[model samples]
Target: MTQQGGTWPDDSETVPLDSGSAPASFVPKSTARRAQSTRPMPQRVGAGAQSYPDTSQFPAQPVSASAQGGAYSNGAQYRQYQQNRQYPQYQQYPQNPQYQQNQQYSNGWQYQQYPQYQQVPAAAPAVAAAPKRTHTRKSPKHGFLALLMWLATAGIVCIMAIREIPFGIDGSRWVPLIAGFVPWLAIASALFLLLSLLWHRRLLAVVSLVCLIFQVVWHIGFFVPTTSLSDEAKQAVTQTDANGLPISTDKYARIMTFNTTTGKADVNAIINEVREQHVEVLCLQEMTEGFVQRLEAAGIDNVLPYHIVAELHHGDNGGCNGIWSLSPMQNVSGDLVEVDASRVAAATITLGDSQVRFVSVHPSSPTRGNQGIWGEGLSSLSSLKEYDHTYVLMGDFNATWDHANFRNILGSRFVDSSQQSGGGFHMTYPANSKIPPLIEIDHIVHDKGVVVGDMQTVELAGSDHRALLATLEAQ
Candidate 1:
């Protein structure tokens, strides 16, 4: 056996722990040169020279300071390999920051792991996948919604802007009639504009915004005027009589105008309501001979003693209008004015030295293709304005403020009693039917000085038409 520092009998070497070296025979002089050429070799003990390399114990080698330049001693390197067995030994070949962190050993030894025999192929350099292009596109749903909103905009604009453009046919006039509600259509368009903006539809928003502004400017009056009377007339509504009491319609006079549906009314109910409600003047439409007898039998004359009945078109739906008064009618005249297939009655009643003229006007039903005659009824009634007394024309005019023809014909000479008196839009006519009146076809049109303090609709039995009672005071 070899003793420490002893030369073998064959003149072999001995281990010297202080002299920094690896086993001289196991590692070639070339490896030693390479290790020393890359770094300052660390302190190590050289193994004694042997014929064959030891299988169990690796040769001790110099410790290198930097892993980039050198490696650990062979024994320490085996230990590092055992510890990092999960990773490949070629850690430092493609040197990077990640390799430095992963190749560090717990024992403070650091080394590269390039394989000795493996040769890296020099193929074409890898081409990193071009970064996938990303793009933002609007959803198809967004486009569809924008389209729908634009249709809504076009529809509203067509109704409002093109309605009044005269169509060649007579039936086409219904377009303007229906388009009278453009105010409502414009409001809906404005709502759609808001919805379009919320959904981020840029094109739809711009288009709808433009249409909404135009319509809003065109039909700016969104709400009903609280008072249609002039500033002076409105102030006169608060005036007091000479007696210092609030000179109101209820003080002395209340007038009622009604289309009794060809006198299919409860006459007893009418007479009783007149007496209880203190209705001084009553204008009735569609009164036939049998209807007058029934009204007389029910004692309507007991409540209103004086009356002027116009039987011009008696027996027809447009026939038999009467103006009945509680006071004796001074200038009672049923021939106030005449229109074919229509009836108009007028009378003057004395009220505290003031004679108030009342007229019963029944325009032909605009339905049944008689809109022309219906217009004529309103035209003939316009003559009542020439009366010397304060004029009160009331009955079933068969027209609402929605009727542009009625409003145009009346012009500035009349005020709608319901609108002027704050009665609002009360629906009358077509009463006693399953679906009650949804429109105000009956109205009271009066001259300026006649103040409508109150207007109400009364439902009566056996009559398709309801009654309108408008209380009045002279301003």
Candidate 2:
């Protein structure tokens, strides 16, 4: 075979030997580029293939040696062609400039000038910073102590109420009346504690209601006017005349006792009732000079003129005791009984065919600072037993039947005209309030010789207590 001018196989070098061997046929790299370009692209392989005319720039492919080993040998173009026959239509674009320009396409990796979007620096992963710690505070045990102290103060007030007990020796006993505050405070405290203990249940509500009722009952007895008397010592000795003549019949007298509250509208109402009822004897407590003057001006005669105690010093006389009688009054004296100055008097009156003795007393009320005085006054008055001639003892003793002192008086020989005649105890307090009336603190008590004819609560004036009226019959 004749040799070509200059070009040789890229991987081959000529050697002067083996003249008897057969010469192989040459295949140009251009032909290979054309063949590769004309072939269809592979379906699975995403990699693309391009062709060049000159082998000087294109990468060379290694020759295969054996079919079993996926290699090639000399004079095996047919076999090699069959091996690469999957891409038959691939063609080289070295001869076509227009095709080369068409091949310049944007792959996924190539970028176009799309408004020059600046590649923002990728934000570093945010560090999970540790949560900031804060210090906390709390109240100490002393705070609890402060709260307890507040509760204790209220508790003490309640206890004071329970300690007050009504204990007296006679019907005219006033000891309990004076000592009422002690038990009152103590009971209140005990009740308060009980309520607190039961607070979590429906029982609490029930207990609270019970306590309220009990307290109401207790206060009704406390504030209502009552005369503590013992009948044993107050026996009506005899009925006699002013001349010591014994003339007796079933005749009686009307007596009334009232608390006028400084002679306001209440006193006027009391006086009006007394005038209407023709009460033979009228006893009033918490008397004022203006009120007495007004009553005197209103034709109230035979008033016991005496200044006893001064609860208040308003207008030269505040809460003083006085008695207004239709009969000639005697033994009119106003002195400090136990606490403040008070009035006491006796009068002999002719009732129809009988002569009756009337004793009026104004005792100190057991209120706040006057508790001691009330107790002493009640006891002192009960022990007097000075009158025995068909006498009627009536006044505002400032104690209630529920009190021990009042019970003691009941035990005495004195008869409660109201309880015996008026059916039930009549309460007279907080005149304007709608709550139930309290007790018969304003009272009429006499020895068994004097029978209770009638008893009632008269019309009220501007006073806190309604007027008490009683008619007694000599036995």
Candidate 3:
């Protein structure tokens, strides 16, 4: 057989060879191409595959070794084809020119080379945070309570000021009347001060404190002793007079003054007090003829035989005044106080070698339409200071120490026996009444030269005024 194109011709011709060799088989080239087409195509898988042509359009099928030639018969040509079908070497992708250089983007999506953001640690869970607390508003009641406390404090301060300064504003009668209740007012101010502190009111507390301080400084002396005195010295009686009454060679005398409520007082109570206290001089206001008769019948004369009673007219009511003394007494009613003589009974008595003029005074009360008369009567007593003798003025003046008019009557020469004795406050008026006595309208006032001791008050039935007793000695 002849060879053409390096392939054996398919003419069914046979070539003689050496004896004893078997016949060899050959696969035609067209059949070999059809077999190769049915095999699976190998696909390249990365950027390197872009340069190769795709062979996926060919259908795949399985081929057996018998259908194709055995592998060793065409191994050299098959290895040459494998070497030609190798995929292109892998290459890196090309970068876009726009992305190569830094540029700003209008759409806010440009790939900019920003500075590296610091890596933040993971946050703890929200459950780890503390919860918030809600607050409630204050009620209006608290504000209203504070307001009432402030108003009370203000009122207390005003009252204390009025009592202390004694402005006597508008010439109003209420000025003197309000002054009488200053002690109670001071107590109210203290209560207000405590309330202000509890309520946390700064202004109210300050005002209350100031007012309380003023009251304590001004009135504390009334309750606390200003002078010290021994019990024996206060009650010392050096001698007895011929009338069996107590007297002292040092010119000491025990005296008492009482208003009998228009002769309604129990005469036995007054007599017993005078006897027990050994009072040398007893002055009486609102004296009546019937009261004088009752006192005489009660044997008041046995203890104090000397007496000078103002003559009472038939219609005199209870305007008369009288004085009874253990020692001899001379009437000085006209010589001592000529004004309101009927209401003021004056007498001079000898104590040891000294002469003491005693006056039982009853001033018109400061009732409505009577303030003028009351003032005149209190002013009239000021003339007593002009006398050279030691004077002891006692009885119901219808005025308290708080009254500006009463203090003026005291002047510089005279002082209240209660105050001079350091006996503190002794309220003596409105006795034997539903309400206890709240003011010291009955007082014993003497010259400053007189040494006063052991001032006291006694309550007697049926009398509106208490009996004020004081021990006096001439200096």
RMSD of 1: 10.1
**TM-score of every prediction relative to native:** 0.62, 0.45, 0.66
- Spell out the clash pairs found in candidate 1: none
Highest-scoring model, lDDT: 3
Q: Tally clashes: model 2.
A: 66
Ranking by lDDT: 3, 1, 2
Clashing pairs in 3: none
lDDT of 3 by residue, 165-206 (tens): 532231356665666676666677777778767666667778
The lDDT values for all models are 0.62, 0.50, 0.66
lDDT of 1 at 85: 43
Find the number of clashing residue pairs for candidate 3. 0
Instruction: Rank the candidate models, highest TM-score first.
Output: 3, 1, 2
What is the model-wide C-alpha lDDT for candidate 2?
0.50
Residue 54's lDDT within candidate 2 is 27
